[model samples]
Target: MENKKEINRRKFIKVLGAGATVSTAALYGCAPGNHSSSTDNPALGEVPIDKMTYRVNPTTGDRVSILGYGCMRWPLQAAPDGKGEVIDQDAVNELVDYAIAHGVNYFDTSPVYVQGFSERATGIALKRHPRDKFFIATKMSNFQNYTRENSIEMYRQSFKDLQVDYLDYYLLHSVGGGSGIKTFHERYIDNGVLDFLLKEREAGRIRNLGWSFHGAVDVFDYLLALDVKWDFVQIQLNYVDWKHASGNNVNADYLYGELAKRDIPAVIMEPLLGGRLSRLNDHLVGRLKQRRPENSVASWAFRFAGSYPGVLTVLSGMTYMEHLQDNIRTYSPLQPLTDEEKDFLEETAQLMLKYPTIPCNDCKYCMPCPYGLDIPAILLHYNRCVNEGNVPKSRQDENYQRARRAFLVGYDRSVPRLRQASHCTGCNQCNPHCPQGIDIPKDLHRIDQFVEQLKQDTL
Candidate 1:
């Protein structure tokens, strides 16, 4: 006898596989039985599915969907054996079908995404459709094994796993982040991997070649300065990173500007700053909502990313049907931001810097903590409290008593006592895994001290 929660989880997975419109409508609070039309709910009026905006790759003449699908965060459910987690393949297939029918033609995945199963799952889903209908983008992702043989083997494995004869787009995964310029050179330049990839492109096995950047401006400049013509480049671009990049000194504005100057098509990632831009403070939310009352907060980020002339595509990791629908509507007929609107968002970014919130995207890459701390939940609760005005600055503030009570109550309710931040031992094992470059141990320690002070009412 399964519990109600377990039964509902299974039911949801089934619903996702049955049909796209029905599943998405049900997920968004519409009646499940009435699968006739989406217009039943005024909220989901009618997405211009056939009117999706597109941009062309100047080098290859590929008309890519501006809203490219990122296959990193697929929906997950407990395996039938109830032993471990597994991607819900049926749901993935339905989502892929729905996306393609609605005008999306690009999908991005990597060897290491989704516990190393993303590429295979993506291939399985996309293979059911016409091969010429959608473009496949994947990466070498051999960040560790720099040996030429290992690199070549990894590259070949991607094609086999993807079930594709030739990749439409390929990237050097996470360039410039870990070991800086020297490691980058040792991985690609010294090892002859770059030369091999260039040859693959020349041979038509790889249609386009580029790299996804993370840190170290010198490395970015170094790659761009090469004689090799890069067909496209991916960078983290959002209103927040445009001006206030968290850990990296380089900003998206500079990155985009550099690419634009070089006539290189820029592929945008982290347009929502790993969901931070979507979940904004009440004050900022009010500011945005007041203008576009019908739009979601996430749509603003998408529009901003698409406004650039150099952008070839903006990648979003949509795990749920509702996310897919919302993004589809946003990009169907993208409303480019006006200069005034851009200024307003820039001002909002400046104001957001005043409050210190950890830039954790809840990606869950760093999980199963050795110390049993729920890192994402801790950071989420803290950020939520900050957004809702439940974080009191001092004990003397007028709302300190109420805010303190709310924060403490919410923190405990959100995260179990055994998995709270106070249990962190500063192991620092999670630091290297975070894509956002967050200082995990330092943040956990600081948060633990803050929680202790809240308990003692000393701060």
Candidate 2:
């Protein structure tokens, strides 16, 4: 009979199918469980400028930083007119300046991020630095308008918005979504967009070309099986998703294995599972704290992604000064995970799986809902209540009254009355854009119904 370690490893292999690449003893480290006990957080300290870890791009030999800056959630401020919000230029510049000063050189952005202002905000911030000092990566992001003309114009607009003559890295953003191959072909091949991009690569306008995956395993396999020489690819990776992926996502073990086998460098996204890992429950936080009290809850996830030799970079959307500082400290000479530590994280993932939480990364892809419902805020609040154990099952439970009060109070504080889940009209407009494959209208309605039940005094 096998020991617990061997048994767990075999079980993981059987479930994931391509278990050769992932291991209970090795993958990314992430805290799992509740966040209320996450108070034992590591203190921030000095980040070394010359100590940043670098990865070599085999195709172009570009030396990219192990920690890449993801420009998806830039800091925002109320617009002068107070009608809405806009990216905070000063805040962005400070973050960029500090990141570069600490040796981070790779910055990734797309046309769809930050309500279509990410490219412009990122451009404004990065323009302060010398061209040779950093690498710029952006995407076509033409999900709605995939016509050849519209796609090419979208691609060109990136150059104008970013104020760059050429892009260091370019991608067919959010591929492999929904209809899988059909959507991929219609978005790139059928519209001649891929052909145009290849020609752009030939003209030296795009230094490296790749795509991000978010759907079926067949779609990923089909893309890799193609004749095109992919420079690098981005995928959602973290401890939880390594073998036990939620929703419609494929396991990361298979995704990473295929890329490693082809020697295709991988750019990791959602390393924290949309910030799920960092904000683990109290019990889970205690487990990680017992082993390494000095490391932040978020560091485990970052080290896991950077530990893989085949990974070119790990992206983090740093919106605050402390987050940027903490991430820099984690990657400024990364300390790879040990076999024991990796096994511990695998166990954490299993325990976390037992607790059902919605897979919302707060990427804000489902923003500006036609019905005025705040999608991410609602889902994130629901997940937080789940992690904190505030969602009551029955009025007869011991703490039912307390739990109900907390949920209702927190819900109102976290989301406005008019923009709460109750406001979701089930328009289905925000469904396709979600990378996590969440059933937006369905989940929203479910949450709304739950709130209504909680309001009732009936047992």
Candidate 3:
């Protein structure tokens, strides 16, 4: 396996070492241009500065761009000391420059994204531009140590890092994770942090206050029933997850319906289903291509999310110029999906349910595995092979040699040796953080066993 072929097996997967979204473009099998430097990629020029769709917030009357920027997966590079990774500030500036120029004004970040580097980098990039050029959003990500002091500190620090006097949008970040309502109360209500945020909103410091939901429907309804008037709410909405929500997540149809019922503007997330929809199986890809030959498979999801009148903006965590360019093209003067097209995507979603891919969104909430395993990379690589039809079942399979080598070699190439699935220690620290409610340890163990089996069958 120590050959040139093995080393370069996944050369096209990683972009600027953004383990976050590197494989997002793997289906195209084309290595991206240098997005690390300030150098321009002509594709960036194609992003329309005027054609972007805009939606109004009924409460504030703020006209937000429909194509919002999710700052969770910023471009990354190896740090100077080579000990760990760091956000690529120059790349972020370029990405921000093109996004603002292309009429993208809604930028969302969180205290938890990019290992707490997202807000700082986003602030640095946007600082050069006029403050009115963008509407910045961040979260009260008091997932742990949600004591009143800690949670309040986390909230205040966001202002400092974002370099903003007032946050345009502030969230109660990814509620309903552990113990559902119990966790919600402890994280926000019991600690008085929710009251503090609500007060800030009244003082004009937080223009819009909302929460991003990721768990039980009861919690979603519970939050909606609260006396507080939510300005906007974020939920994972894509064609596949609209009706057939997996894991602890609520279906997008229900989530959106409830938000619309309350007349609340919605901020959409996970339009790509963690890149699974884009890297669909060959037959599915062909089906989509047959319908819209010029459109990217990923565009269908964006169209689905943006088609709804209730959606204020659809967020895409773009890490490269091409991803940004492709999204801008899709949303430029937005084309709402017709009834027939919506039905087609629903059928496509039903077909996608059959594939056995793990639902890791690469949110990296379950990151910094104590034992050094790269959880998202391991799961995503497995997902890619599954989509590509490269995960062979047994040695007797006709494509055994090709598939086996593809799995083994691609796994090694995409994930560093120390960070491979074999390193997972089943410590279970990553379980509660997973918004999809994946049994991280069990899945890692199963994947490790599969890899070991593949290695032993040398035939």
Is 2 or 3 the stronger prediction by TM-score? 3
Q: lDDT of candidate 1?
A: 0.80
Tens-digit lDDT string for candidate 3 (1-459): 334422332241222233443333232221122112111121233557789999999999999999999998888877676644578899999999999999999999997777667899999999999998999999999876778998988888998999999999999999989999999999999888889988999999999999999999889889999999999999999998999888898889999998899899999999989877777887888898899877777888889999999999999999878989988998998899999999999999999888898998878778656666778878887877777777899777888888888778777766777778888888788898899989999999999999999999887
RMSD of each: 7.9, 11.3, 7.0
Q: Give, for candidate 3, the lowest lDDT window spanning 10 residues.
A: 34-43
| Rank order (by lDDT, best first) | 3, 2, 1
Q: Give each model a TM-score.
A: 0.86, 0.90, 0.91
Summarize candidate 1's per-residue lDDT along 1-459 as a digit string, tens digits: 235533543453343321211112112111112222221111254767699999989998999999999998887766676645578899999999999999999999998676567899999999999899999999988755688998999899999889999999999988886778888888898999999999999999999999998877998999999899999999999998998887743799999999999999999999987676776776787787898878787888889999998999999998878778888998888889999989988998998888788887665556546666768778867776676677888977888987887777777766678878888988786776576788888888887888888899744
Model 2, residue 378: C-alpha shift (Å) = 0.7
Q: Order the candidates by TM-score, highest first — what do you get?
A: 3, 2, 1
lDDT leader = 3
TM-score, cand. 3 vs. native: 0.91
Q: What does the lDDT come to for candidate 2?
A: 0.82
The Cα RMSD of model 1 versus the native structure comes to 7.9
TM-score of structure candidate 1: 0.86
- lDDT per residue, candidate 2, 1-459, as tens digits? 225533543453343222121111111111132223343244467877889999999999999999999998787766666544567889999999999999999999998776567899899989999998899999988766668998989899999999989999999888888698999999999988899999999999999999988888899999999999999999999989999887768899899999999999999999999888987877887788888788788999999888889999999988778878888889989999998888889999999888778898887666556555668878877777777777888877788877787777777766668878888778797888787889999999998998999988545
